[model samples]
Target: MSATATTTVTATDSPRKGRSGARPLHLPGGISLRVERRALAVGVLLTAAALALAVVLIGTGDFPIAPWDVVQTLLGNGTPANDFIVNDLRLPRVLVALLVGAALGMAGGVFQSVSRNPLGSPDLLGFGYGSAVGALVVIILFKGGATEVAVGALAGGLLAGVAVYLLAYKQGIQGYRLVLVGIGASAILIAVIQYLITKAQMIEATRAMVWLTGSLAGRDWAQVWPLLAVCAVLFPLVLGQGRALRMMEMGDDAAHAVGVRVERTRMLLMLAAILLTTAASAAAGPISFVALAAPQLARRLTRSPGGNLLTGALMGSVLLMVSDLASQRAFGADQLPVGVVTGLVGGIYLLWLLVTERRAGRI
Candidate 1:
């Protein structure tokens, strides 16, 4: 090749490379193409619909503010009574639901995506139980409230998740093996929860009942702070690994060939997922089904073969908001545990999933 031609090519390529580095650009629809963008749009629309449902449900309580009043109060232009009811009373509850639901949705997405199992979720795979066990230990044994409970829950969840990993590591981590181990671990943890309940004094047990069953009633800023912390840290950490995770999901050999550190990436993602789930549980005891359902729901709505983390988070927020609203208004003033409402819905969905899988011989 002529020196002049080579020099010209190098000069042209250098500016293009420099611009790519400087901008680090992403398209409006993200890295993937049209299908992903369309699915993302659908998930977002569904989430918005769910949020609207939550507003109606929340406003229909005993002191009853209309939807317009709720909007007015939200915009800082409503009557004092309406403002207090909507903002002071219901707003905090809604915030907690959104936080917890978003955390669970992302946690579920992380677990299922990292483990490569659609059935793997924090609640289903024992991470929730681990957090619950930890929080219960703190509340029951040490008489600690929010702060200690949060720490204990995070510790317990990580420990339980590690235990499941070790047990399933007999040959090496495979998706199905990890899930089966998690199921067994969850069963044992449930027994432990029952034992703790039986051993506690009645008053403590009654208070713990709220934790065990998962209720958003009387939730104040204390619970909100921990969730905020988790969201702040965990989301960034997980998001930073988005490119790495996308590669790892394609299997270890393929990922390794692409200059990825498979084991380390998996471990980090697993730990992040555990921490997110633990923090949510600590904030509000295993709120149930949202963790198990949000990712699948996101995937189905988006028609994506795998979970979309952002979409899943939105779906989760909507699920919890709607469910908590239902629990609060379905009966009366006091409100049922949000867990009960989610459990009923989640359980039915789970059963249907099993039936479909069995019929298709996918199980």
Candidate 2:
């Protein structure tokens, strides 16, 4: 063989027989786990901030416990009034906010990672609308209560997700196609929801109206239990599939080359995301923007290339808790829906993302 050809053979073969049985030198998917370390820090900071905001708001309630009193109550040493304000009312609300936010964040992170698009979220993809459609159907048709409505929402979100997947699969499930199809599906569901709202009595509409806005008000342990069920089931399932999800960002063929079941993995992740979103929506009526905004904010905070699931969940919880606080305090007579507050902020952020993408020539 020619010297150059011999050299090329040696160079190619050498790495295939390294000290530890000849391994690939490259990081998986041209991405490094090193970046995710900072994600942990960002998640912690965001969680602390969220807790602080919740505490501050709890202390400033109608009863007005001091910060110290709030701490004492949290630690089981405060006055009865302080305990009542923090543990009974505000604590449950905060816990719900955190749970809902975490679910949205996790769902959003999964969707964004799967789609490889920052804009792909449960809210934007119509999953939230699916939940609404389901809940509305139960509320209107069956006169179901909150629990029943929640189940309907879950079923609706899953059905919508499946429909989107089937529709988007015709062309090999391109990211943009999936997003577009999901958006269209969501519009149809929204129309159905509107129709249901119109047909229902005003009293019935009152419940739907409150649910539509995604408020955490009146969410006691009952709502919290269902959310817990969802988290308990879905959280670990998603985490277990993280490696497969990471593999998928490199496109189907590449993921498959690494022994990842690309289609199955994507489908499972999508389903999990749907379940989480549905559970959250059922609990709090499609609380807006946490699913859309948290992951993006997490990426920014961690200075990572894209979303981190853990960090996104923490950021989401914080965002929701802070929004809830604002809603409770900012309006004197009428407490605004937490979802509305998140939607306003998230909408602006979405616009900003669009502008940034355009500026970066990604459009």
Candidate 3:
């Protein structure tokens, strides 16, 4: 091989941990574990920031409780009134917001990695629109409640992912092809959603529109518990596949040459991402831009290339919570949907991203 070709091959074959500046720790039986310090540091800092924000968010509003009281109430130690407001009233909403953000962020990491595209996300891949279609069908046609709507959204997202996969599967699912097919599916599903909206009764249409905008208002333990359960199962599943995902970013042929089971890894990651997207959508109504922006933001924060699932998830949680706070207080008692805040911010971020990518000749 030519010198340059040989050099490229060597770099592509290098251990990813080394590229990330990961450190090794000695262990029993002559074993060792590698940890990426930057990702770890970023994760810890984001966790602290997210928790602090959560506490402050929980403490705000009429009949305000102190941060300490919010903490205590969360720990099951607060008095009845504080508990009523914190636990019964607010905690679930905040928790849902955090979980929804985390789920979407991690899912974004998965999709972006699989597609090798910065714009690859549930928001653009038709899953969100599919969830919306399912949800609108339930809300407008069947007159379903929150729980039913969540179930429908989940079903819709999964079906959308499958359809996108099937359409993109020609010649074994190329990265760009998957993204293009997914975006096309999203556009079509959006039209379906609009049609459903036109068919709804006035009251149902109002509620459906609000749900479409994605609010945390009236969220309770019901939303929290199911979403938490999904996150518990899916977070580790997706993170376990992160290394293989980063490998796939090197290209499928190279990854397959390394015994990475490229197609299997891609399929598993896609399924996991789809489920996470649906779960977040089910919980929070496909709150915009968190899926699109969180992973990218987390990677930049860590000074990493991309696909740090944990950091991305933490960053996602933080973004959603911050947006939730802004939505509640940014206006004077208007109490907008959390989706509105994220949508506005995400829109601006999207424009900046496009311009930045254009400058870099990547768009």
Candidate 4:
């Protein structure tokens, strides 16, 4: 009977022999990746879709350029009017949306995978509020410039993450404890933001409110370069830890038994997530729920287990671009902030998540 059970388990674990041949690519430090053809196909399709949507957005704005003109302008060939509209006016906003969305999505994926909870995103876990508080201080009290606001946001997010980690650390960190602490920290930070807004002068208050709502209205290369630099440095670091993160989902003991340094890996991933969230928030003022919803959305689209970082990043880019387009075109001439649209949509997604989790007995 034992032998029969062993045989059954082995057969179940083995990959099918004939369907889509498996390609095993070995890496340094004994890491390996199983490349699936179907996954590759899905990735290509998603990328194409995202690019198509971006083109549509660039060509459909107020000073609308033709799609052909947009493509030519992107390639440095269109007439000056087309060039001005696509290259100068529309392109930067689209780029910022893509980069920020990707950063937030990747951050969400890391946090969710590390905590082994769907509610473990930066927005839900307090990092976004923390960054917002930092930026608010610069905007209201100091009347600082854009660079200063970005730096303050980064500092605030890092500080918030450390505080929550220390407070949640008991014998060891647990998902539920970290989440609870983060939510509390987030609330406190939000209250601080509200107070600061109230004390500012009318003009400053209006600016603060718009920034808090996460607009990409006048975003230019100034916003784009900083976020691009941060994502370039941090995304690779996060992707490298994907294997260890997957191991961690099986519990610390199991991960440790598999030669993973559980605590160290979690700390590193958490730091990366915080930095990603900070950079994105600094650029776009906590664009609500891209971090919260992007990873799970990607997971469903790919039907893959674990983080699905690449797909998550793509989905985030698509979601933000679509939202920005909707905000500009949906309500006639009174252009809304991208954050407003996301906030409305994300609120619904949050409610549905809660209901679903409750039904599954995981809430």
Estimate the Cα RMSD of every predicted model relative to the unseen true structure. Answer: 8.4, 8.5, 5.0, 5.7
Tell me which of candidates 2 and 4 scores higher on lDDT: 4
Name the TM-score of candidate 4. Answer: 0.91
Task: Tell me the tens digit of each residue's lDDT in model 4 across 98-169.
Answer: 999999988998888877899999987898888888888998999988889889888888888888889988
What is the Cα-based lDDT of residue 206 in candidate 3? 96
Candidate 2 per-residue lDDT, tens place, 257-331, comes to: 979878888888888888899888888888877888888877676654433676777778888888888888888
* lDDT of each residue in 232-329, candidate 3, tens digit only: 99877776666566667788887788678888878988998999999999988979999889889987876665487778888899999999889878
For model 3 the local lDDT of residue 323 reads: 95
Instruction: Give one clash count per candidate, in the order shown.
Output: 0, 1, 0, 0
lDDT winner: 3
The C-alpha local distance difference test score for the whole of candidate 4 amounts to 0.81
| TM-score list, all predictions | 0.85, 0.87, 0.93, 0.91
Candidate order by lDDT, decreasing, is 3, 4, 2, 1
Whole-model lDDT per candidate: 0.75, 0.77, 0.83, 0.81
RMSD of 2: 8.5
**Cα deviation in Å at residue 101, candidate 2?**
0.6
| lDDT digits (tens) for residues 1-363 of candidate 1 | 000010110101123434322223245554421223355356558667766865775586678878887887788999999888887787767778888998999889888877787788987789889988888888888899778877888899989989987887754478888899999999999999889989998877887787889878777777787788889988767755655566666777877897877778778878888888888887778888788889888777654444467678788888888787778777776778889999988999899988887898878
* Cand. 3 Cα-lDDT: 0.83
- Candidate 2 achieves a global lDDT of 0.77
